[model samples]
Target: MKQSNFTTWFKSGSPWVWMNAGAVAIAVIMTLGLLILIAVRGLSHFWPADIVEAEYTIPGQPAITLLGEVTTREQVPTERLQGAGLPVDPEQNEFMDRELLKVGNRDLYGADFRWIVADWLSNERYPEDVIAIERREWGNFYGYLLSVSHDGEVVAEGEQAIDALQAAVERASGIYDEIHSLETGAIGKINTELERLRLRERGYELDNALTADRQAELEAERAVQNARYAELESELVDLYREFNRDSIMTRAMDGQEKRISLSAIVRVFQPNAMGITDKIGHYFAKLWEFVSDEPREANTEGGVFPAIFGTVLMVLLMSIIVTPFGVLAAVYLREYAKQGFVTRTIRIAVNNLAGVPSIVYGVFGLGFFIYFLGGNIDQLFFREALPSPTLGTGGMLWASLTLALLTVPVVIVATEEGLTRIPRSLREGSLALGATKAETLWKVILPMSSPAMMTGLILAVARAAGEVAPLMLVGVVKLAPTLPLNANYPYLHLDQKFMHLGFHIYDVGFQSPNVEAARPLVYATALLLVGVIASLNFAAVAIRNHLREKYKALEN
Candidate 1:
């Protein structure tokens, strides 16, 4: 009787329903758990962790002074520690506490991080005067301030040293900012103009139209550009001199004294002395810099603004190119094409294309769009830039076009589904009112299908924004400091390579020289990429919902 009751429940589908619900619940829990883990590990990278100084000892070695921020803690098997040639007493405990410390001053030690056995550490202390210095290069420096100097003379020391050092840093930083502005701004403009002039001259020379007077005119323009460049160069020299006029002396954990030029230092803060409010403020400041500044230190440091900008721009360009073409194709397939085997075969092919590997699309883009089509265009219009392959190279324009092609099938399928959903009575009613089929499609059919088109776009963007494989071949680069859009004429430079968050994460996570340093950043960049894609999809979904509501009456 009990067995029969169990069989009855299974046959009634109750057990199946319960199983499905359990699967769904488990999936949701796993997804949320992963996201939470990523958030905690990634976002904490920028927090102001208190610096700890301790005396580290081993069973057979003398103690060494260690100063660093505690990055992470974990438990290791005692056997694993002993296997690594560490003296671990397996009898004491089966597991051992292991801690990772970010010991800075890479120039001195040649390593930024070290894993130490926690059981051997003693005399842990947090000193208020110990400062952490963020530098433009060589990672970071952790030490105590010794003195401040101007040029080669000691200008401030003792009690007034920190205050004097801060003032000097501010001055040096201001000069550095000016020098940066000159390099990327004014000097950059000059470089662009020079390239344009050279290209123009090359075109004229290639066409055999370079008369003596024309040659002289080009030479005169070149001379003027050179003069401007010289003036800027002289100004830059002065700025560099002032920028390097100050320096700070510091004492490291090993009691070794080092002098760091203020020009190379980005910021100095005593993290252990910082209050809660100060740490919070510092965290936000670091976060903002990560979002707003250009990358530095081999794409590991600074902000990813360029990647964010390029990803958005490429997606926008793809949307603009794909929408009209996909809609027209869908219109032809569903409304104009005859309901025969040919149309059926074409629809089958389109659906199959959607499942093709993304890397395959990347290869297609590289071969056809860049090598064949782009090379031909460069040959026809940019003959003077031959061999240089201006348009023939992988660039943002080709990347956008490649993505448009890859996603157009999705749009076609979506729009076709939307077209099929519209009632035939609506078309008949429009025709009865003397409207042509074209007019009916434009005014009635297309409006009702608008939501589906947006759905296609959202899907396309969601997939494309996180795509690293295709973009690596087409346009995305490991580093692209200069943005595509600028104040220069022909404002948008589509032929230039750009950065993407997806590729940035791959490069940081897999190719970085610093493993531990890049781990948290891998999480952070992954989170940022997800956020960016989500933001784009959310906007599209909102539009889709609005369109659906607006066309509800027509659909009914």
Candidate 2:
């Protein structure tokens, strides 16, 4: 039997199909690999590794005892090590291995890490008594607990000191938490109330409504608030004294004894003595701290809750602003407008906007939104806070609006495509039933196309959540002292600058003075950003799927 052309083509299979499949496989593999790498590097940071005590010696220097966790190890060329001003043996192998030890005693040694050649280390020991102290100010401290004290007098010594120290820390931490709540909650509320009253009084003056009765009422309220504040202040003073009452003595690797106040320590644990279960518990505790606590030590230590909160809030605000605007524009273009040269031009422009570089949007947002629009707003409404700039500067509001504008094209294109996919028969059927165009669009057409609209929103959110450059130019800061949303009136402070995880990664990776310390945090933060974006995308996908299922019968 002779082979026909159709048989030959079918036997060979489709080149385009094979090529696309290969491309997709490669992309999937790359994405999975990247995510795995980020997860390993980031999540491993919380594990409490065993601490090593080693005696290190150099060719010309005396031996010194080093105590720390071995963070990393790498092979280096002997010539490179020599070039870096380290002593290396030329007679030995061409390559030399070195270990990076996190010998944290920043306040004592002035450095948190040190690199030593593998050949120079000896007598490595993992002592059960070796303690790692995570502090509030200085970095981690590796030492031995010598004694527990109160008011400059020793109360417990030896192993008993450890128990005493833990108990005291627990009590002091409770006191600290109470103090923080009083200061930032109750006291903060009073301050916010005072500020609101001041602003209201100013507004009254501006409106020429500061009547004598109103003035008396304001004064009486102020007096009551002042009296309450004085009572809180007295309580705060007592709490502070209680927090500072206990202290502990520690001996460093070099036998240098020092007294560390309990208030300075956040957590103390002997990692070398921990079993699998204890290590697991400690890991969870550390992870919780990373996600809930405020960053300390120039953002090299502590948690990233602020950055996470800001990124989510900004993305949500952007979504709210973009969805309506995008839907209206897409609806007009695809359904209401005449399909002519002008409409085509507008559609072309919208598509082109999506291709514009993100930084260009950032620059435009800075110039037009901040300088022009924001400046006008501040001048007209906030003259009392003039020279300080109020809304005349970059803020969360401008950042959200800027991102909405940047991502609107994506939403428009997706929604238009969705609207285009609806059958003409459906539109005709609704119109034939005596429905007007507007009523048909609102009641019938829009409901069927909701899945597509959600698809656009999903794309917009994916892009906006990962955006750092535009956010930086508009409002993102390295550290925000307060979150944008709080318990105060109006609740959301749109005019405040805020932190973002994407920008946090950038700052911690590039802008930080401590590269070694911040590198792991970069991976951790990048992983977090990916998870956040994925979570948001997944939610949108679920909604779209639900809408698709609901409207499938209508399409048929």
Best by TM-score: 1
Instruction: Give TM per candidate.
Output: 0.97, 0.96
Model 1 scores worst on lDDT over the 10 consecutive residues at: 294-303
In candidate 1, the residue pairs with backbone N, CA or C atoms under 3 Å apart (3 or more residues apart, or in different chains) clash, namely: none
Q: What is the Å distance of residue 227 in model 1 from its true position?
A: 2.3
Model 2 lDDT per residue over 423-524, tens place: 999999999999999999999999999999999999999999999998889999999988899987778999999999999999999998778889899999
Give stretches of model 2 more than 4 Å off. Answer: 1-13, 203-215
- Give the poorly placed runs of model 1, Cα more than 4 Å off: 1-12
- As a whole number from 0 to 100, the lDDT of residue 81 in candidate 2 is 87
Error of 1 at 168 (Å): 2.3
**Local accuracy of candidate 1 as per-residue lDDT tens digits, 430-518:** 99999999999999999999999998888888887878899989989999868888866678999999999989999989998888888
